[model samples]
Target: MTITSQDQKVRGKNSYTFDEFLEKRSSLDWYKNDPILQKALKKYAGAKYEQIHNELQHFSSAVSSRWNPLAERAARPEARPSMLHFDAFNHRIDRVVRPMETHQLEKEVFGAGLFSSKMPAWESFAKRMLIHQLGEAGVACPLTCTIGLIALLEQYPNEDIPELEQILQHTKEGLEGDFAIGAQFMTEIQGGSDLPANVLEAVPDGKYYRLFGNKFFCSVAHADYSVVTAKISGTDKVSTFIVPSWLSGDKDKEKRNGYEINRIKWKMGTAELPTGEFQYNGALAYPVGPAGKGVAIAAGIVLTLSRLEIGIACAGFMLRAAREASLYGNFRTVFGKKVKDYPLSVRTLKKIEDAAHRTTAGAFKIYHQFLFLDQPLNAGIPVDQPIELRKQLFNLRELVLLQKICATNEGAEVLRDAISVFAGHGVMEEFSSLPRIFRDIVVNEQWEGPRNLLLTQIYRDIQRVTDWYPSADFVANVLEGASQETIDRFAEQLTDLLQRPVCGEVSEASMEAAEEWDVFCDSFFKAYQKIALEELQ
Candidate 1:
């Protein structure tokens, strides 16, 4: 049983060194190393390509070398954001206490002036895509919310409300070199996705409104301002408003604007972000648009932007998963051969890579269309617009939903498969980022709208617009570059499904149809993504 020196030498010689994998991973500059993304940037960024590319080079390198580590530190179990309900004086200041790394990460990310007027849309969009690779390291949700807020403000400029203008300036430009963070408080206990059912009251108070009710799910609870949705004081109509977290000069005093954070929700993923339940008691809120048109504005602008960003975020998640997984595969030796050389590993790696490329390509393609159209998303069909423009708008609307559902589903799948390549090392949180990214992707799948909800929404949407844009034509338009046979197959399937009910009173026929519709939608979006990938190639 005594160990021989010869056996010890043999054991040492066979020992595994993961230096190669670590070296390759650490050396990667997310932008410069990604030719696919580079090609995408060049193609879609158009005239702003050079400047944006240059900026991304520095930005992405910093993300890989600097921010990513901060994100890692922030994501640690002990570093999760917490609530401090009272200070030394026992005052009711619901402060969100976070780690130093999170604070630094948030400061630098907001300091980029991403939503500022001086930054081109393409630049901001590209920057966001890069940032999303770090997963929801707290900043991602805030970034998404802030952009939506800026878009809402820009959509409805109210010079009459000086506070509204000042809030916009704080977020869009900086106020004394400090960029404001934004959050959206929409989901109430009574309703989550059902915005119309919300009971939060927005009582008129002079020129401003006072919000009084509880927001059940408020992410980025520590934000400077929030885009709140509430029912008008006496009316049933849901309206959107911008509510500052603290009145002027109150932030330093830790005096919240008539609201208190009940508690921070223990989330399954995006642990670095602070999601809290809030009780609003006469919080001063400024209306964003017409009182009755809040639902439309929220859906058309705010929620739409968030869904679109989810697609982009999923693409970033897949890209990182695909890249790092491939690197690990190539470096690790198994059964006397590299992991990449195994047939199973090869197939798995290819699937992950393909999904990553398809998702990334589809995201860029959709964004390009969005930028080209340069129009606000209108809830329901815009029958007032010219036929072609209306059809294009409809196409964008449906495509956004399609991408959000499909990309998140596949991003989670891809990350799961990528983790498998590392075997036991993958599931260990400290060993890899894949587990955290995978969890974040799962959380994202439910955000904005879950799959079944979105599927039902799309079906209803098509039913509403069928007279103008037929289900068959919709298929053809969405999958523009796909083969005729492929388009016809989907078109026929969709047309048949339209005749049946996919939601409510689940019968055998409806159940069967629902299953078929779910499969058909996923397949159809993959076809569209393939076409996008072809165009990019």
Candidate 2:
């Protein structure tokens, strides 16, 4: 943990010493008391307190090994650029996107039982790490694709496990080293989010499909391959295809595929990642999943997991921002005392802490639900209906949506408070990461389905129990002795929302109602907490 001359240079102006950094990195004290988390981590991550230090060391070494060589080569002032250029940025991203880093982490951590007993630990770990890594990026299209593929795999009961494994391995290898893959589906021209609404057509030739169309809002233009969702000939069904940067029978040798990058998007946040539009003729593609079911599959698998990850990422970003603010308040002086000494600052910090704790708790609660649904017992069955299994699945989905909504919304609020706590220092890029964190929060909100879209989904779930409330007994059990007044109030709101037809349709009125419904659900969750506390008592 010694601070070498090099370490001292890098750590300049940072509050923590090198030894403190090492200690913090090595310790799991942050998570130690959470038995559920400990069990899950040990089962999945293969890291106990005893081995966590060594494991962290290994992870650091791995990161340094790849970065060091490139750092050395670019040490020349002339070779290094002031800004990370597009090509260079793309190259760095491509290297990290591979399966070796992502999937390997999954297999080693969750799959290997670093914490507790769980099946398909690899999938679970991948999902977790994706959140940990890309949550900050905001609109990470490639990350969405990766999770979507896993979800799709889960749907095919008869798929060969080995074949699926091979596909994942191939995808990991292809994506490794790329930070973001370009998204070609959305367009100013296209009216809907549906890909079939896409005018892009792919011609079939043996196993490959040749694409011919222009797409807007491609997130990662520098990616090695573009997973384009296009319409296949002879049917109205939309299908996903993998189109590589380099392909056969192309006129522009250096250009490889016929696609030409049009322009990069200038956005409100996440400016570091490029979003672009492109047009191509005869770009080769390999089909993903079955034809026509692309939208359903995307929603169920890709969008859902991405939404969950966005929630998790928001929580992490909020943690980092809150920690920075808290540390600053402890040191910065105002009125002849540390700002933290002031009751107002203390209250703000406490609110951040409570929010963070709730977000983590909510996310973990959903993660457990994901584990439950993924278990073999629930496989092949529709997530809804079937008595016992139905209840578990229903709760799992509801909790996941709830956490996604709560974490993203509250994370944004916490980040804003963190910025306020730092005063002038927070807004400056040099003084704090608050600005970047704020951008990250905005991105999290936009990613997956937007807040209103998610709220509507939840309202639909609540409406499903029209005649009698859905999970009424469970709600009562959780809300027992909650002053009945609060319970009845929430029940009344729920009944009113359910009575109106708001599910399966997207309208301004419906969206407003959904937002109100979400508020009611929040109150309901608070009531449940009272019930849980009474049970513990």
Candidate 3:
């Protein structure tokens, strides 16, 4: 046989998904395959199990077949939202116009109760996870923000604000076929995590206050209502507010509530979302909590909910990416044999599968505990036993932060590895959803809080306890279902790790401590995850 350049050019080609040729029935039923998910739901959903599971399966199919194409199309630069600074008459409308695809998905999703509180909190979050399997596609941030808004409304209902009832009714209950989407505008050029440094001004204006400042990151800028933080004129303390898109009685009209949509910010991922930097020009704002409690409320409630969603969404992304990769590899051929039969490919797929399993187990385990917290305070425990409350809170805080930082970062890498299995075809957006999912997961890594911030939060939170480090007890308690040997070993390991130096100074000396802190948190969470996965089984 003549060895020629043309002969060398014809080797085994790169493989993508066979999803198009396969019938709908051949598709993976995420609900059925995910026994860990089923097990977790068993701990919380009670009689609603079968119903929720069925609904999730249906939603999964819709995401894969129908909505995904539209959603992906919406991610195109030309398809995203743009501002209409004025109307034909030159009125300052300050409108952010999204594509019809985005509007359609929002309508379908809002009605599905993605952000509505009408359903039990656990079930609502479960549905969100299911939708997230389709990747953020720009919708995840808004949905989580809307859920955060609902949480705030439920926590601090204001009877003085006459419009609160209607906003709640529309957003939480989807009243009369109308649903309101919610957004959070917290980031400023000056203040990243330091809410106290926020300089946005809010002054008394009859019943509502008027806001005057600029927000550097206004995700879901077109949302019907926004949860914003601003300093009252008299003090520098930040307070939370529910700011409407339009004034009262201006429904379905062009009038904005005295704010300007500066421009949609270009982003690397989640292109379906319309994140912008905007300025408030006397925007009407109604305080949600007390003046000085803004930082506590925002951190304790809004950001916490967003971070939790990040954890769940991270797991879902890993599972979907792994499934696609595994499915493709099993049928794909390289050289003379099926790719899955190759030792190296098999090893890679197995590792990806294991990561998916670990993340799913940890996410649902934390989710079960979260559902308990959402119930009446001291749920299932006597009111006098306040220690139990502290234990659960400590465990949940560490779990959520750890999972968000680790899983999102790991999920992106999982997708990267998955794409490698596809060789050249992996980078081609038209060939598979991996490329898009890869970009989205990268964004998820830094969305709510970046890696370093979350690590600092977990370390600081663990260090703050005095009488007893509740996180130590919290970690021990969640690992209860595992073997005593496993539990005892982890207890010793965790205690030893907790004793390490916390990240403080910024010098080369401090940099050494920071690296050590990062490495320890990573190792500790991996161990916790092993126990969690065992418990799930």
Candidate 4:
């Protein structure tokens, strides 16, 4: 055989990519193999371990094969969903036209009861973890809203409100038939974080109300129902109402509710979910609870659940990024040597991997506490729990805010570090998921609560509750698995720090002191997270 010039050219050029033709996935028994995950499951789930484990494995496989591709395809901004404000003949119809990938992913994930709390505690959270690990694959946000709605439904079991019960049942039993999704339209054009300042107008109409206002950020805008807040024509109170996507009799004609999509938002991350602006034109709504309780209920129910899931989702993001980075580092070469062999590269990879593990450990630890505390809170008996339960629950509430801060911030940091290991290929969208996950984490950093808001909330909370809060005592409980010396070091420091509250009127000096305290609290929480990881082990 004679060797041709083209054959020589092909043989001389390298076409293989990093770790190609390899399985490049975690073991199928992901839940079974994770010691820390199982430990957390046992702490809460007990006898349901084996069942949950099998379920998690099945979900993991489906996510890896089906969701991964679907999400990647839909994540492109060009492939993003569009809102149809008119029917084929150009009549007004507020219908969201999403890629088929989104509908399939939602049906697969939510229909599998990923949004249900009715499953085993650990199992429910595990399914959510899987969905979130897909990183805003157009489903997690709506699923999150639905989860909050379910939690609120538990609080307000209104038998007479057939619509509430009907929609709630459909979301829970979506696996059976008629899968429903939920969303919240809280932030208005004038207010982003100021929930109480919303000025959406609501006029009484028989038993229902008609709303007219604009919502600034409406993710999952295609959801079947929205938990919206508006002020009654004569009152200053902000009240919550459940608004169906389409009016009761309109389903037959595919008619929409009394709202129109102003425009879909162009965001930096999580393009799979179509977040948009909307104008409510006398949209019929039903009250969720007593008037003027909307802001409180919105924060207590919807935002709380969203923040809790953000921590886990961010952790999931870190885990995925770290795994891919480590696998890449294992096989990649630089300067004529394997990248992982280099001391600096090894340290970076270790840092990313450790952060991923610690984040996962900390998130599960919170989920364990969340299951316990969320029950009493949802029951509206905040003061009814035993002192220890009360204390842990209170701490968990503050910690949920803190966890969102730390998990997402660290997820972004570790993901960037993971990208660094990939060198040139890291920034390329097609190379790996690092870039998209990086963007998702950045967006999540600002979701539910921002860093400054959360940090101040923690510091202020420590001060406000200092009289009853044994800061050292709470630290000791969470750090039960740490070394005695380690426990004493952070406990003593946090106790002393918590004791010094800024006294009297606000001034430049006190403001400066608060900033310094914020830095100290940041370190204090990182140490606490380290202790949480140890405890999980």
Ranking 2 against 3 by TM-score, winner: 3
Better of 3 and 4 by TM-score: 4
List the candidate 2 regions with Cα displacement exceeding 4 Å: 1-144, 150-167, 172-189, 192-196, 248-255, 375-385, 464-489, 501-515, 521-537
Highest lDDT against the true fold, candidate? 1
- In candidate 3, what are the lDDT values of residues 6-124, reduced to their tens digit? 76777665656665524432456666666666777766677887777777777766766667767777766687678788889988777777788877777787778655545665577
Compute the lDDT of residue 408 as modeled in candidate 2: 69
Candidate 1 residue 93 Cα shift, in angstroms, is: 0.9
Candidate structures ordered by TM-score, highest first: 1, 4, 3, 2
Residue range 126-196, candidate 4, lDDT tens digits? 77776677888898788888888877776777776777888778777663666789888898878887888
Estimate, for each residue in 416-481, the C-alpha lDDT of model 2 and write its tens digit: 898888888678754555676576677767655566677777776655643343645435433557
Q: What TM-score, over all chains together, does every model reach?
A: 0.97, 0.70, 0.90, 0.92
Compare the candidates by TM-score and give the number of the best one: 1
Candidate 2 displacement at residue 316 in angstroms? 0.7
**What is the C-alpha RMSD, rounded to one decimal, of candidate 4?**
3.0
On lDDT, the stronger of 1 and 4 is: 1
